[model samples]
Target: MKKILFAFALSCIGFISTNAQSLYNSNSYFGSSSSTSISSTNSSVRYQQGYTRKDGTYVNGHMKTRSNNTNHDNFSTIGNSNPYTGSTGSVAKDYSVGAYNYGSGKTIHTGSRGGQYYINGNGNKTYVPKRRTRY
Candidate 1:
C-alpha cells in the first residue's frame, strides 16, 4: 500500500512537470515580433513666388496678417459663439422609439419577457411564442 501511494505521487509529479515543460516550449506558438522596414520616396519639384525686400528678406504675400484685417468683428463673432443655444423647447426623442415608428407601434423588445416576447438589443420587437407549461 505504501509503495503504491508513493508511485502514484511520483507519477503525478512527473506528469505535472512534463505538462509545464511542454507549455514553456510552446511559447513561440503564441506570437513573435520581428524587425520590419517601411520606406517611401518621392521625387517632385514644386515652386511658388512671393514678396521679397531689396535686403533679401523673403515675405509670405499669401498669408493674411491680423494687423491689416478689416473683419476683426467676424473673428469676435466666431470666438464668442455659443455651441449650445440652451433652448429647452427642443425635446430629444429616444432613438429606440424610432424603430417602432416604421409602422409597428411597439417598443423595441428587450428579452426580459421570458414567455412569448423578446426585445433584442436594437429595440426591435420580436414575438417568440411561449413554450408549453409543464404541469
Candidate 2:
C-alpha cells in the first residue's frame, strides 16, 4: 500500500509540473525579448533592441521620451497635461487609431507586468502586444 501511494503521489507531482510549465510558456513567451534595431521617428516604434539579463533572460523595449502633440484628446499636450505623469506637451502628434494601436486611445496605461494596455468601452483592460517591425 505504501509503494502504491508513493507512486501515485510522484505521478501527480509530475503531471502538475508539466501543466505549470505549459502555462508559464504560453504567458511568458513574449516576455523573452528578441528585438534588434533603433527607431528614428517621433512616432512610437513597436520593437526596440532587446538585452539579455544576468539570468540569461531577455528583456525587450527601450525607454522613449514623451511625444509632443497638440491633439486635445492627448493627455501629453500643454493644456491637457497628463494627470498621471503631470507632463506637458506640444502640437505634433499622430491622432490615428488602428485595430491594434493603443497609443491612439484617449488614455494609455501601464499594466502590472509593465505591459501597455488601454481601457475599452466595456471597462476592461485591452493589452496591446509589441508588434515586430519589418526591417
* Per-residue lDDT of candidate 1, residues 71-132 (tens digit): 22111221221112212222112222322233233332324534234466666555432233
Evaluate model 1: give its lDDT: 0.34
lDDT of 1 at 39: 18
In order, candidate lDDTs are 0.34, 0.45
After superposition, candidate 1 runs with Cα above 4 Å error: 28-30, 34-135
TM-score, cand. 2: 0.22
lDDT of 2 by residue, 1-135 (tens): 997996686566556645644654453554547353321222321223578966699986442334343233444433334322346654333332332354463466655655555788777776553222225
- Cα-based TM-score, every candidate: 0.22, 0.22
Q: Could you tell me which residue pairs clash in candidate 1?
A: 108-123, 109-119, 110-119
